[model samples]
Target: MTRMFRDPVFGLDADVVRRSVENVAPPGAATDIVDLFARAAWSGIAEPGDSTAGFLVSAVGASAALAMLVERWSADRIVRESMVDVDTAAFATQLDRALVRWLPRLDSRSTVRQLTLAATCRAVLVTPEHPSWPERLDDLGPHAPLALWLRGRTDALRDTAHSVALVGARAATGYGEHVAMEAGSGLADRGFVIVSGAAYGIDGMAHRAALASQSTTVAFLAGGVDRPYPSGHSNLIGRIIDTGAVVSEVPCGGAPSKWRFLQRNRLIAAVGDATIVLEAGWRSGSLNTAGHAAALGRPLGAVPGPITSAASAGCHRLIREYGAVCVTTVDEMAELAGMSPGETNEDAAARSSEETRVLDALSVRSPRSPGDIATRSGLPVGTVQSVLGLLELGDLVAEKPEGWVFVPQRP
Candidate 1:
């Protein structure tokens, strides 16, 4: 049953809620107040990359989906009402799993409260229906954001035709920061928007250089646009909001967790035409962004530092092992942005087939045995054994007491 509440308790009749957020709704959108309210609610309820919320909003309207959850509808009822069916029972499996996750977050009061807070912060909501929503985000397909909570000029997101993502180690060396600055200003002067997560080290340097070049830049955050994370970058983030944009998939007040930071990487890779790893240690989170770009089949580039620098070890791993093109100058990066394709067929022709798969199975955060890696990579244990031997010899991988781990080359 469809229902509307006009309770004297919160006294939030639909019109009253609509009037409160009227200014930030995307101009010319249908803007039924409930839809605006639901998007805000969904941002808070689901963590970034929540497929169930993404799919539901894409299928049913955001308003109806939010209403179903707010009413505490059953999983079966949700599937029946929203039509989230798929072949061979996949839809049933997805919906069943989703119910377990979504049930705990069904409070409508929290949604209303978050919306009220966002209004006070002057944050804006941009759904796919908005004129400013970047179409490149649709490349994520079902994984596209439900809505983006933004604190800067929404118009800056309108054209991402010339955007490049510059990411690297948070604890960057002076060499890394210098390269990032040069790449940022050079790319910006050549007419590209600089995009990076607003972390310290390389990301901060990139944004600053883009600003110095007088170019539009954007920060894709792991937390709420309203929250300045690293708390150190508060001033830099404010500068971005004034000049470019700060965007997030999470609503106002959401905290940046480790998992959210990992999830936020995909957005950075997807929005930019190409991604540059100015520097990263072997286990640097920046590699996560490079992995996403490679998975999306977008061009990826890495800068080379002296062999002595541990900070650039990840870049070496990407180039020598995973086939990332070595980009020494902004012109090469421009080529990646579309003047030329990244690595040539010859570079690909040179890779040992097992190298990429074995590397993929290994994680920077944990260790895995050769047998376990075979399972993740779907290769025979014998083949994994041979590749691990080769990788170990190259110092691309290390053996720990627990198992083998991907690590930086020790000086």
Candidate 2:
């Protein structure tokens, strides 16, 4: 039987899409580009960490899964008819709900758009079959992304097998930023690729320090690689694409939301060999990433900050409550993450554990309270006014609306 080989969208030969995939295909990726295309479609259809998406793709195939969604098959029919070989009872339980969540977003154009957008953005979709695919992510089991939508150096992802994730608050303070910079630069110097979500504050500082140290860094975005999140970091993200990679589970044109951000944190935790909360507030989202790392059995690190700082409270909580290793210096972070001796960063700066640099951030000229200060500084503010009075004595700044302004220094 002569099977017709064609892409339903372009009505051209299926090989047309296959050739397009080759633009970003690494040396060891799946040779069949059509299957790669299917995975890309499904990536957009399902949200990140959708186990049902993983199960469907695993039981059948990306192409067949796409076909199931395309044809609008019912959950009962899919389990009874298509997934006949599998254990139906358990899979069917959640199958209906999964379809409900997935079907509303199901637009054929959505999948087609991912391919066209990938070509325009010079992006690649890497599946488990790909040689450069980070094998460690498979440890996520059914929660693994259906496939990765990537831009930048595909080779950089392989480093994820031995990478460290440094994540913390976006409203970082001078102290927190300094530690993040030191930690990021120091870890990158140690030959470990840095992994993070490219948000402002801690995540941004980590990415910057990694690049400054001339080490590769990969960022996982909550949205499509085509549309980077926090839009403020466009230039920073652009720089990353030139050297490392920006990856996402969602397809092109997808906007980021609150749920996606939380889900994206899991990828950050999963992609790294270890995860460290450089500085986090009590309710900071970085703590969420820390939770995933702990759950995944990845070594977790919490950098200690001032005892009074609410910014580092999350880190303190982790150290005290979650059993996260206390990682003060870069060496400790490396040791905590189990960095191989051979992976040492030769030109790493000669800095001791006790040495801490203050990475000052000039906040917007508005009255911010001590809590806000700690959030920005990665320090905790004392609930007592005496602490502010002490700094006032030091001539740091006269208080205005309970906020502070730097006092001019004596020459």
Candidate 3:
């Protein structure tokens, strides 16, 4: 078995040090491999307890020839080894220049903390060699990211057979909230785990609805999986950690940033079987995810809403101009995910519409006179007065001496 360690940076997973120490080849060459890779990764010297040293050790320990090259091979030789056939000297020069430019940034405290956290988060770090790695991501070719930082259920990651990303504006309206809940809950019922960023507004509503339905959901964070952004959803994020996964690439302790947010959406698009835009404005970030999904030739879906709604404009534009499929019910989302919508469960109505009507007749600020119900519901005043009498009988709505209004059962 590959020896693993509890990495202090990531909190739980096997640390690079453990992997290097146990897996180092040639038996007695452990110290040599560790020293060479650590120094190469940290500019030809080793520092105790340094993560940069750990990374170097892990990267070069895979091949002793690569390890030795750090001391002997020029940048050209390094490039030659990296590819099947390339100009060795020129490649070495290019590699050296690139390393010179890139290595300093790695020394930054922020970068160190982020990479260490990334290495440790419960999320598994998948490599190209990992059997569970999805081949479809190779479609991006060289443009694809180096690796993925995954949290939540690994089954969802390994099963690329089907998944859907549902995203929208964070500042959701009542319509957006209702639609997000319906879509998320409906998708969950259909066996499609809802995937989304755990932002406020639509994202929060979608996660809550998915959880309420007792279905799986995945959240992709722009920062480290350990650090939930927006802080307000810390509780909801905790629930997500329990029921689903939280994912990132930048490593633990990485602060959420504008660039990372946009970059993270590409993973959501590539991994998902489809991407759905429930609600967004012209400037919404959700559209970026949609664009990536489209570019990847994945099926894209959008929810239709009132044209007058600014929040709906992005969805409308995608459907009307970009050929995105229009969806409403969970069945549609399920079919798009290549699954069948299972039988729906029925829940007994806790309150009837008549009871709701009575409650609506009452205002939070003041009692609505019996005449107010007639105006609000477009019913005859006599009918309204009778309904009010029944509601009053039920103690749902109250009648003030001056007129009538609502008094909630609670506060």
lDDT of 1 at 8: 23
Candidate 1 TM-score versus the reference: 0.78
lDDT of 3 by residue, 1-411 (tens): 121212332222334444532332211122433332222233212221223223323434323322333344555544444452545665455556555544444332443344345445554444444555556666555445444456656555554434578899988889999989998887776566678889998888888898999887878788767788879999998888688777665555557888778877877787776788889998899999999899987778899899899989999999998999888876666545433244221110244455444443445345567677777656778877777787678565576777776543331
In model 1, state the lDDT of residue 47. 75
Candidate 3 stretches with Cα past 4 Å from truth are 1-16, 19-75, 84-101, 107-124, 128-135, 340-411
C-alpha root-mean-square deviation, each candidate = 11.7, 14.6, 18.7
State candidate 3's TM-score: 0.63
lDDT of all predictions: 0.80, 0.77, 0.62
Residue 265's C-alpha lDDT in candidate 2? 91
Candidate 3's displacement at residue 184, Å, is: 0.9
Ranking by lDDT: 1, 2, 3
Maximum-lDDT candidate: 1
Q: Per-residue alpha-carbon lDDT of model 1 for 124-158, expressed as tens digits?
A: 88888888888888888778888898887888887
